[model samples]
Target chain A: MSADRPLEKLRVLVADDSPAMRGIVRAVLSGFGCDRVFEAENGLQALAVTESGGIDLVICDWKMAPCDGIELVRALRDPARSRDPFLPVIMLTAYSETARVREARDAGATEFLAKPFTAETLYQRIAAVINRPRPFVRADGFNGPDRRRLERDHSGAERRQARQS
Target chain B: MSQAKPYEIINPPNKLKAKTGSIPAVNPEAIKRAEEALEQVKSEFRNWLAEEVRKLERAHADIHANGLGGKHGEALFVVAHDLRGLGSTYEFPIVTRLAKSMCKLIETAEKRAAAPRALVDAHVGAIRAALIQNIRSDTDMVGRELVEELERQVIARVGAEG
Candidate 1:
């Protein structure tokens, strides 16, 4: 609960079909000092909000109708359609399987939070995106935040060469 | 890099604005107020859960009467999934665990027509019992044992079919 936490100024959008889930997320964001929290019932609505601009972070559910979290992330990362392709998107889902996590990551989500998450866990994620923002990657196959979770000291030349090859 | 099109303009405009360079400080009073609101929401958990249980019960009946693979099965999965995610947040860890197990049971069932009715019933029953007995903790020995038994049954049934 640091007074200078980065979450205080963030305008977060929480997208979920369940009203209860949306309320809980808004409450958690409020605890983090986020005064401007918006809600979307599905990915379609979430996309509209994202397109309208000014959304710093998105916390989206996986199993929404008309559009799911993966579809939303893909749309946001698409250079032709995205308003802010670099916007941090966090996928909040109950499906903790490897396949689902991979799908979310490949679709350009900045982070993945499993459902039944604690308040502390949520805080840590928001902090991660704020304090330690990742450089966005725009390679032939990938167009989102860097997917690497591990930190290493590879040389800049080596990294660029690796990406090119 | 290509510039993306601006979003469609909505009336009254969205209230969310871009962040300034300096992060705002956390207000202790705001945190306290949010916590109070959360507590108020939790206080109404029993009624909400009861309503979910009724929906689940109806879904179960629909499945039994008309068989699975229809809207009833889908409804059952949706409700169970919601319970799985919300139970722990609302201080009902046992419900979360049970509902998670139930979700898996439904997910792995080979065919809708072949769903294990007894196993589904056990899970639904355990959820109701957990709420009635106020079994909120996953560490509760009785609750743990019940969950394990239900999981074992589901695995065995699915295994047998496979």
Candidate 2:
């Protein structure tokens, strides 16, 4: 076997309406040593899981009702909430079109994997997203109180500017 | 093309049977809809994980520096609760697995005279990696137009009378 990937035992969310598709994804992920797998039938359920918390990776179908992948990405990237910072999104779908690919990017997807994907493709994409960590700062501010104060002051100034406008 | 016959009939599969069918080509629209819904879940999950990681880190900091009251522990608790729910809903065993681990870590730490910050930090790192992988999975999946069409239909039907 190859050098064991550090991501072994990683948690993954598999959201698809089809039990077969979900099973396939789970099996594929487990083949790479992903022992923890999650499944959701719809976007709303997926959102609940996401919001509920602790997901390491999400492998979602491109199509679902009420909320689709694109809309989900848009919601997650909402500037107002800073919903998920640097969350990598890998879209799984059967729609093979250049325009659609472009749109997925616009929808805030970190990576795109077309349907009928091989195990290699799945592992590779998962590897890429998992390897890169998002940049984050403690709510108290990384630098010190001075830095926190500075940020607060900046926000205050912005608020005043908005009022003036 | 064969001519229509009296014996031939179009028995469209019922909703449950249609959903149960393994072959995706039978209903492109349904597949697309499923894909889009899954996508949305994946995206939201990514963000949620990111935020949880940050919160976990903050909790660690609070324990190390000022100790667990005020905003840090509260945030950690909130994120942990969310993870527990998400894990069960999405069918991701690891999310719940880690969430339970972290939740216990926090709850136990709170009861202790001096919390174990180091162990908590290690768990936080593990959870963070898991969250990142989740996001990557979301982006890697494909099939866009079908999902888009589903989105369009949902929009068109949201206000329609039954």
Candidate 3:
């Protein structure tokens, strides 16, 4: 309830090959009062960690060994392999180009955070995923957020829940 | 890839909100605290940066030994890309700038062979110099000019390729 511990209860997973980066992100998350942070070296490991369940949020690097971020997102979105297809995923990458952003989106990433990222930027991204989650669209070549959202209101929670039913 | 057709939109439950969104207002102190936390470990950042630079050098060595064509060139790109992402975080934004330029120069294996070896070496050298000399950010005028010149050449090379 206090401002200092807003992220205290959140369980976060950071998937990156760089140990330095993992430590930096873990430090920042710890500063935000998030104690349950998980680390994975690549997408495959991230998948293993998530498949075992109990991960609240995911922050993943775009480039990784064997299985990259795109592959991870796709795997997580797949019904057969994923435990929680609706889980929120924040795709972390240095590629800020429109094509790469679109690629991540189409692959089913819930959010995108470009690298050279600041702590504030990372916080805002976490906040964005929490404060606003786009409705998942089941369509051709896309299984994530509705890419064509036009700012129309969702009305209310009950209405959304009813639609899900 | 959605088109003008029938598509189902499912508003998944805001599980994250249920978990940690009761307090809508973000605390600025959270960011300040995170920054301070990073500062507490600032001394170690240089060592971490040096290790990354050495990895970049090894990748560059692979480029020299294998002629920037196969897995070796890809390795160079990976190291440069990681540095481009982590340099600023490790307190060397100038390294980030140089790495970004380097990334643009040899982003793909196809471009690696065509990229001038000297230009690539200059980027690798500048990155190491930034770490060794403690040129952390773009505030250093020489570092800024060096990055700009390298970026210019990379761009011109691409333009010529077109």
Candidate 4:
């Protein structure tokens, strides 16, 4: 597990009306070594960013004046418009009410971060979401000293399994 | 009237006070840019607050039409709490003060076991008046200062009355 994985180019969108809150988020994200961070003041602006594409993740506050984080999530997760419907969204909220949290989760938020969270919490969450491996599987049963031996053994086994399936 | 408290009184466990300073952390040029950005936000925030004040007026009018206590009082408390929190955050001291007073009135109504239509209506009217005053203001700084003075007077009067 090298620290320098190829996640440097990932773009994250942060939506919060408070300049103070936005600054804290940007500082924390930068501390995590993420280079591409975009910000929006409200859900409407966040929606525009999503429409423009290339955003890997969205972290939004739930209580903007109008068209809040839930509405934002609905718009971004809309199958009709999005290139990827399961775009992981993390919602930030000051209110820690259980019912509201459940409502946000039901509205398609992948994660919820309560206000006044730490930098460590923020980084841990981003790392967990972004580091998920794509589906390309390989298995080797034999002990091989070199690459050629491992490839020969795995390829032979994979072909046999593919034929059986 | 019901025996319900209006304010949440979040003690923050460790009492995490907000940091204040005479100068900003960013460089002079960066501070200038931040201020410009903040000015834009301030304008937009003022409009948003004005819109909320109108909505608050409408909500109070509804309270008068249907009376307070029961579900209406509960809803009123929820909105008032929201106004207090956001108003304080954005430096709208008057709205926050007015909202706090309304919260107390609502709390009183709840504690009384039965809020009469007339008394409840009076409280609702006061809330509406404060909201109207908020929208007529020209700038946030002025609105905030005036509101603080108004709040002091209001709290004093409420104290004297009690």
Candidate 5:
């Protein structure tokens, strides 16, 4: 997690249908010191790559042929199908609407970066996923990282306070 | 600040080395490299942009050749979506705005039919103009006026049809 080497020794996956987008993402990943970057043209391919294992993070586009990012996330979070359900995922898309953001979040995305994003924003999201790892949550209807940014106990005290004692 | 936690995946085909406990610092050199790579992509965008514009033109021609409502209209939607996604990234913010407006028009049109010919023409024409003129800034007066006029026409057309 060292800021100086955020992506050191990590394997990342970039999934998108556009060759241009894939190249750009790969370049960005390389700049971040992630040398072992894998590329997949669609969600299905991404799933296959993830299943093969060794990937530390996934950066996926929202739209693609055969399968999409949301579908990919759903499958990845499914304990029956996922190789590593705890793997961090960042969803990228041109659509920045509230509905799109909510859809990705509900689908278990670790981070959301809107399209036309700068390297700084991309790096910030990567930092967030690595430095602020959220605990996974498994409920009857949902199986993914916890959605809440802040954690509180039943009595409304911060969960960290309980750990402090 | 809490100690940086070492996150590990329980199972992996190949295990990775444990990372240190500090947030990765933003490397200026990396940013520069990324920017340079993006610039290379941008340089190639002119060809891509030209191709997309040609597709738009052909689609428009097809609509004229085979009447309205057909595969051509769908093609316009696809092209507009592409432009909307790529324009700003390729340093053509105005094109993005115009294409997004065009998408709204094509999307809101009744049925899967081609949008009103005049509106479609206006949107296509404006996009071509923006690209040819190399209007990169969203606030450029001419580009802003062109977008506003196209938007106005689209709204009027949609309203009349509704």
Candidate 6:
């Protein structure tokens, strides 16, 4: 995040089934000095944008045909299939249930933002992803950010070896 | 003792920070700009919301013409779900509340078949009323009562217990 225009250089992609919601999200992203915003009507389109390259972050909706947001996240986190396996994703949708949040987190989402969101809320989520990037975790049947509750300095291979051991 | 699940953690390069590390996370000016940007598009909200409402009504109308069994019922759920997400952003938080209650009523197809049509009608009517009456929130008396009743009925219907 920058001082005057934190998201100026950031290229973000918004994926939802609704064109109206996409427009609204674009307007907000534009407000944050994010001139390089992209829109996708569904998860497949979002995948195309991400695969083509240059998208910094993704704000995805949970419901869409052919491929939904959760499916998209799973695809993105698949090391064999994804162009950027560690891409930061913020799941934004109307589903506010604790179960849904857990589902999104388990799908490899970097952060979660429920809809009817204000610019401040959106900004806070984006900032959290950037300012505190999580170390990616790869385990049996799980591939995503480290699911630890606390944040710690993970700057060396020694710490990685210790955790694996 | 059970062995710990073996996992490898990799610290991906923080490109975002590397690109813009000097900037602080909380930028008041940027937030203001974003709010202002939202305001810029506020003019089109009414028409956009009306269109969405029409979609909901059409889906509901389908439920009327055809019974609330399969596609007709699922269609209604889809529109209500979208409204549940869109109402507040469209500047009608009341619509969101009503639509949410509507969603609860028909969250699943099984629930849809069991749900009383009258309850669904109340939610649809309330959403239309919010837009037609220009009621933004439940602060207004009618809005408050309608929401409370709708939520009460939906909770009862869905076994949510309100």
Model 5 chain B, poorest ten-residue lDDT window?
B8-17
Q: Which ranking of candidates, highest lDDT first?
A: 6, 3, 1, 5, 4, 2
What i-RMS does each candidate reach, in Å? 9.4, 24.1, 4.3, 20.2, 8.0, 2.8
TM-score per candidate, chains pooled = 0.81, 0.40, 0.91, 0.44, 0.78, 0.92
Candidate 3 local lDDT, residue B150: 84
Top DockQ hit: 6
lDDT of 3 by residue, B1-162 (tens): 333544567888988788776654466889888988888887898888889999999999988888888898889999999999988888788888888888888888778879999999999999988888888887899888988898889889875232
What does the lDDT come to for candidate 6? 0.87
Candidate number of the best TM-score: 6
Clash totals for all candidate models: 0, 52, 0, 5, 8, 1
TM-score of 1: 0.81
Ranking by DockQ: 6, 3, 5, 1, 4, 2
Higher-lDDT candidate among 3 and 6? 6
DockQ values, each candidate = 0.22, 0.01, 0.46, 0.03, 0.23, 0.56
Off by over 4 Å in 1: A1-6, A150-165, B1-37, B108-114, B157-162
For model 5, chain A alone compared with the true chain A gives a TM-score of 0.88
For model 6, residues A37-98, the per-residue Cα lDDT tens digits are 89998899999999999888999999787699999999999999899999899999988887
| Candidates ranked by TM-score | 6, 3, 1, 5, 4, 2
True contacts kept of each: 0.24, 0.00, 0.60, 0.00, 0.22, 0.70
Of the candidates numbered 4 and 6, which has the greater TM-score value? 6
RMSD of each: 6.8, 23.9, 4.3, 17.2, 7.2, 3.6
Worst 10 residues of 1 chain A by lDDT: A156-165
Kindly list the per-residue Cα lDDT of model 2 for residues A1-165, writing each as its tens digit.
122323344567777654555765765565554567888876777777777666666777766656777776666555443344334567876544566676776665666787655555665666555443222222211210111211334543221111111
How far off is model 1, as Cα RMSD?
6.8
What would the per-residue lDDT of candidate 1 be over residues B35-106, giving only the tens digit for each residue? 665786787777777777787888888888877676778778878888888788778888888887888778
Model 2: per-residue Cα lDDT at residue B120: 52
Tens digits of per-residue lDDT, candidate 4, B1-162, equal 443222211111110011111112222333333344445455555555555556665766666676565666565555664565445434455555556555544555534245344443544454455456554332556555644554455455445232
lDDT of 5 by residue, B1-162 (tens): 554333222222212224534455455766766667666666777777677678778877886787556556666666676677777777787887788778778853363374667777888888888878888766889888888888777667565232
Better of 3 and 6 by TM-score: 6
